[model samples]
Target: MKTADCDILILPGLAGSEEDHWQARWASRLPTARIVVQDDWHAPEPEAWRRRIAEAVAAARRPVILIAHSLGVVAAVEAAPDFPPDVVRGALLVALPDVEEAPDLPDSVRAFAPLPRDPLPFPSLLVASRTDPHCAYARAEDFAYAWGAQIVDAGDSGHINVASGHGPWPEGLMRLAGFLKTL
Candidate 1:
C-alpha cells in the first residue's frame, strides 16, 4: 500500500526516538505518519505499551502500517493480536532488542522479556543489524522466523539509531517504500 493510503504509526523504543533519530525524521517526512507516545519512555510497561499501540491502530481512519524500532518492536508484535484485524496492512520492524537474553539491558527493559513468538497477524518485515549492541544477529533471525516476518540483514549497522549515524536513513525509507509496494 502507498504511504498516502495508510496511517503510518511510529513506535519508538526506550527513551524514545530523538529528533535526529530515523523514526522522527521519517515522521516529519511522511504526511500520514504519527508517533504513538508512551506514558513513560524511560521505564516502559508492557501492558501500557501494548494498549497504546492497539488504541492507535483502532483509532486510525485508514489501514495502518507500523514502523517500530528496538523495544517498540516487542510492543508492536505483542499488541498485533489486539489490533483490529485486517486494519493493519503491514509493519516495518527494526532493531529488535533481545530483551530475553541480552545481558546489558536495563532492568526496566527486561519487563518486555519472553518476547512474543507467535506469528504476527499482518504482513511484516524485520530489519536486523548484524552489529547491534543490544541484540545478537542470530537471535534476531530467530525472532523473524518466529514472527513469520521477512528478515533483512543490515551489515554492521549499530542499532540503526541516531547514535549509529542513521539520522536521515534514506536507505530505510527506500526499504519501507519497497515493503509498501509488496503490500
Candidate 2:
C-alpha cells in the first residue's frame, strides 16, 4: 500500500530516537507518520510502552503500518495481539538489541532481556547489522527466523542509531520506502 493510504506509526527505541535519529527524520518526512509517544523515554517500562502502542493501533482510523526500531520493536511485539490484526497490515521492525546479555542497559530495558521469541502474526521485516554493538548478526537472524520475519542485512550499521552517524538516515529511509512500497 502507498504511504498516503496508510497510517504509519513510528516507534523509537530505549530513550526514544533523538532529534538526530533516523526514525525522527523519517517521521518528519512522512506526512502520514506519527511517533508512538511513551510516558518516559529515559527509563522505559515494557508494559507502559506496550500499552501506548496498543492504544494507538486501536484508535487509528485508517490501515496501520508500524515502523519500529530497537526497544520499540519489542513493545510492538508484546502489544501485537492487543491490536485488531485486520487493522494493522504489517511492520518494518529494526535493530533488535541482544536481550540475552544486555547488562549495561537501564532497568527498563534490562527487564525486557531474553525477550519472547514468538512469531509475529502479520507480515514484517527485521533489519539488523552484521556488527551492531547492541546485537550480533547471528542472534538477529535467529530472532528474525523465530519471529517469521524476512531479515535485512544492514551491514555494519552500528545499532543503526544517531550516535553511529545516521543523522539523515537517507539510506535507511530508502530501505523503509522500498519495504512500504512492497506493502
Candidate 3:
C-alpha cells in the first residue's frame, strides 16, 4: 500500500530518537508516520514497551506499518502475537541489538533477554550492519531466520543510527519505500 494509506509507527530504541536520528527524520517526512512514545525511554521496561506498541497499533485508523530500531525491534517481535494479524501490515526492523549477549547491558534492557523467536504475523524485513557494535551479523541472520523476515545487509554501518551518521539516510528511505510497496 502507499504510505498515505497506512499508519507508520516509528519505534525508537532506548533513550528515544533525537532530532538528528533517522527514525525521527523519517517520521517527520512521512505524513502518516508518528513516533510511538514510551513512558520511559532511558529505563526501558519490556512489558511497558510492548503495551505502548500494541496501543499504537490499536489506535491506527488504517493498517499499521512499524519502523523499529535497536531495542524497539525486540519489543515489536515480542508484541507481535498480541496484535491482530489484519491490523499490522508490515515492519522494518533495523539494528536489532543482541541484548542476551551484550556486555554491560542496562538492568532495564536486560529484562528483555532471550528474545522471542516466533515468526511475525505480518510481512517484515530485518536490516543489519556488518560492523554494528551492538549485534553480530551472524546473530542478525539467525534472528531473520527465526522471525521469518527478509534480511538486508547494510554493509559496515554502525548501529544504523544518528551516531552512525545516518540522520538523513536516503538509501534506507528507499528500502522503506520498497517494503511499503509490498504491503
Q: Which candidate is the best by TM-score?
A: 1
For model 3, state the Cα shift of residue 168 in Å: 1.0
lDDT of each model, Cα atoms only?
A: 0.95, 0.86, 0.92
What is the alpha-carbon RMSD of candidate 3 to the true structure? 0.8
Clashes of 1: 0
Model 2 spans with C-alpha error above 4 angstroms: none
Q: Which ten residues in a row have the lowest lDDT in candidate 1?
A: 76-85
Per-candidate total of colliding backbone pairs: 0, 1, 1
| TM-score between candidate 3 and the true structure | 0.98
Per-residue C-alpha lDDT of model 2 across residues 1-183, encoded as one tens digit per residue: 888999999999888888888889888989999999999988888788889999999999999999999989888988987898688888998888876665456666877766778888888999998878778899888888998999999998888887777788788778777887787
Ranking by TM-score: 1, 3, 2
List RMSD in Å for every model shown.
Answer: 0.6, 1.3, 0.8
TM-score of model 2 vs. true structure:
0.95
The candidate 3 region of ten consecutive residues with least summed lDDT is 101-110
TM-score (C-alpha) between model 1 and the true structure: 0.99
What's the TM-score of every candidate structure? 0.99, 0.95, 0.98
lDDT by residue for model 3 (42-97), tens: 99989999999998898889989999999999999998888876999999999999
TM-score-superior candidate, 1 or 3: 1
